[model samples]
Target: MSRMRYFTKVEFYNYRADSGGEKAGYYALIFFFYNALIIYLFGLLMYKTDFLERARLYYSNEHLFKLAIYSPIFILELAPLLFLLRSKKENLQSIGLTTSNTAISILLGIVGAIPFTYQIILDFILHKKEIQLEGANLWVEFLILFIFTALPEELMFRGYIQTRITGLIKNKYLAIVVVGLLFALMHIPFQMSMVNMTFMDYLITNWVYMIQLMVMHIYFVYLYTRNNNILVPIISHTLIDYIQLYIK
Candidate 1:
C-alpha cells in the first residue's frame, strides 16, 4: 500500500522561471532518453528471448508486450520522478491527478474522443471493412490496454513528463511540441526493428504514420491542459488505441 502510494501520489513539477534552466534541461533529457532506453531494452528482451513470438500464439502480442515489458518499466521510470517530488514536497494536483472536477473531466474526455471515433468509422467505411473485435477474451484486451498501456503512458507522458517539461522549458507551447516529438521518436526504434527493410526504407515508409502519432500526442497534451486532468487524456488515448484494433 505504501509502495502504491509512492508511485501514484507524486506531485507535479510546476514551472517557475528561475527553475527553468540547465537543471531543468538535464531532467528533461533524463525524462525522455532514459524512458526511451527502458522501452528499447525491453523490446530487445522480448525479441531476443522469443517471448513475444511464443506469447502471440496464445495471447495478443500487444497485450503481452504491455504486460511483460511496458508496465514494469513504466513503474520503474516513474520512481525517480516520484522521489524528486516527494523530496521537494510538491503538490500532486499540479500533475493533473486531482478529482476536483470529475464531472467536467468526463465530459471533456468524451468530447475529446469524438474526432478519433469519427476517423475510425471513416476508415472502416472507406476500406469496406467491418469493425470486428478480435481475440479470445476481448475484456482481457481492454483490461491490459486500459491498465497497463493507457494508464501508464498517460501517467508517464502527460502526467509527469509534460508537467515537468512545462516547468523546464518555460514555454508551455514549445514544451507540448517537444514532448510530442519525443513521444513520436520513442516508437521509432521498436518499429524499425519490426520491419525487414533498411533504416532509410523504414523511415520513408512510416513518415506519415509517425506524423499521425505526433499529432495524436499533441492532441493528448491539449486535452490534458484543457481539463487539467490526466483522466481526460487517459480515456481519450485508451479509446483511440482500442479502436485501432478494429482497423484493417
Candidate 2:
C-alpha cells in the first residue's frame, strides 16, 4: 500500500470551482447554526425544566429515557442534511459515505483511536476508577453512542461542515482548524446544560478539555481526508466514546 495524501490542493480547487463553493459554505453555515440552535434549545430544556425527570418517570427505564433524549437530537442533527441531499439529488457517497476504502479506513480509525484509548486506560489505572460494564446495558450504551453520538456528530462535522469549509476556504489546513474550532464550540451549549455552568465558568474550568477536543477533531479530519471516507472518523469516534464509558 502507498501513503495516502492528507490533502490535494488541485483536487480541492477543482471541487470548489465546480461545486459552487460559496453556496456550499453558505448552506453549511445555515445548517450549523440551525443545529446549534436545536442543541441550545434542547440543552435549555434539559437544564431549566424537569424534562429528564419527566422522561425518566414516563419511560420508567434509564435506557428508554436516554433514547427519548438522544433519538430526537440525532434526527434533528441530520434533518437539514437529509433535506439538502434530497433536494440536491446528492447521494451518500458525496458526503464520504462510500465503502471503497473499507480496509484502510478501518485501519486509520483504529490508529486514530489509540491515543484516547490509552489515555482512558491510564486514567483508570491512575485514578482507580471503577470499570462498569453491565453486559446488556453496555451494548445498549454502545448502540446509543455509535448511532446518536458518533454517527450524527461525525456526519455533521466531518462529513458536511468540514467538507464544505474545505471548498470555501482557500487554505485546506486553515479549513480543518476552523472546523475543529466549530466542532468544539458546538459542544458548549450541551455541556452547559449538563453541568449548569455559565459560559465563562465552563470555559475557565474546561478550557483544557476544549483544546483536547479540537486537537482530536483535527486528527479526525486527517483520517477523513486521508481516506475520503466518513467511516474512518466514525469508527474512531465510536471507539473513543465507548472506551470512555469504562472510566465514567
Candidate 3:
C-alpha cells in the first residue's frame, strides 16, 4: 500500500470533483428538493439537539448577538444548495466542466482585506465603535465555519438553486435577484430564533446589508465566468470573513 500524499495534483482534482458531485444544473434541482428535506431533517434534529436549548451552558445576551450577527453571514449553509448552479469549466479546459483557480482568489482576498481594515481603523479613530478581542482558535473555528458551513451553503444557493431556476427564465439579473431573495429568506429560521424582529425589520435590516452581499455574489459570478473556479469564490469568501472577523 502506498502512503497518501499530503497534497497532490491528482488528489486536488479528485476533491474538486467531490466538491461538485454532479453537473451544475443537475444538483441544482437536487439541492432545491434535498434542501427542503435537509431543513426538515436538520431542523427537527437541531430542535432536539443540544443546539435546541435556549438556556444552555453557553447562553447569554452575547450569544444572542452571536446568533443574530453570524447566522445569515455564515455562508456555508449554501453548500447543500450548490447542486443548483451552472458549471463554467468547459469554457476553460479539458473535462473542464469546471475549474477552481487560486490566483484571483488571492487577489480578491487581498483587496477585501484592505478596505475592511480601513473601516476598523476609522471606527477606532472616531471612538464611535470598538472591536472586542474575543479569544478564538483561528484554524479550528475557521474549519468548522467555512468548510462545514460557508462553502457548502455557497455551493447550494448561489451554485445550485440559482442556476437551475434561472436556466428556465434566461434573464441573468433577474436570476440573481430571485436567488438572492431566496438566499435571504433561507435565513428566516435564524432571524426568527436570534431576535424578535418583524417582517419590516427583516426587509429593512437586510436591504442595507444585502447590497454588499449581492455585490459579493456578483464577484463570485465573475470568477465563475473567468475561471470556472468555485474555489476562488469560496476562498475569497473565507478569507474575507476571517479578515472581517479580525478587523472587527
lDDT of 2: 0.78
Regions of candidate 3 where Cα sits further than 4 Å from its true position? 1-100, 103-118, 121-133, 198-201
**Model 2 alpha-carbon drift over 4 Å, by segment:** 1-14, 122-130, 134-136
- What's the distance in Å from true for residue 222, model 3? 2.2
| By TM-score: ranked, best first | 2, 1, 3
Pairing residues by index, what is the TM-score of model 3?
0.57
When 1 and 3 are scored with lDDT, the better candidate is 1
For each candidate in turn, the TM-score is 0.77, 0.87, 0.57
Q: Write the per-residue lDDT of candidate 3 for residues 20-62, one digit (tens) a residue.
A: 3234345455555555555544544455456556434455554
If ranked by lDDT, best first, what sequence of candidates would result?
2, 1, 3
Residue lDDT tens for model 1, 1-248: 11112122222323544544335446766877877887766666665578766756775556565576556766777777677666556556645778877888878877888897887767778878765665535677767777767777787777767666755666667877888787878887666666545557877888898788789888987788775788898888877787777555
Q: Which stretches of model 1 miss by more than 4 angstroms?
A: 1-14, 19-22, 53-70, 122-131, 196-201
User: Candidate 2, which ten residues in sequence have the lowest lDDT sum?
Assistant: 1-10
Residue 230, candidate 1: alpha-carbon lDDT: 88
Clashes (N, CA, C under 3 Å) per candidate = 0, 0, 26
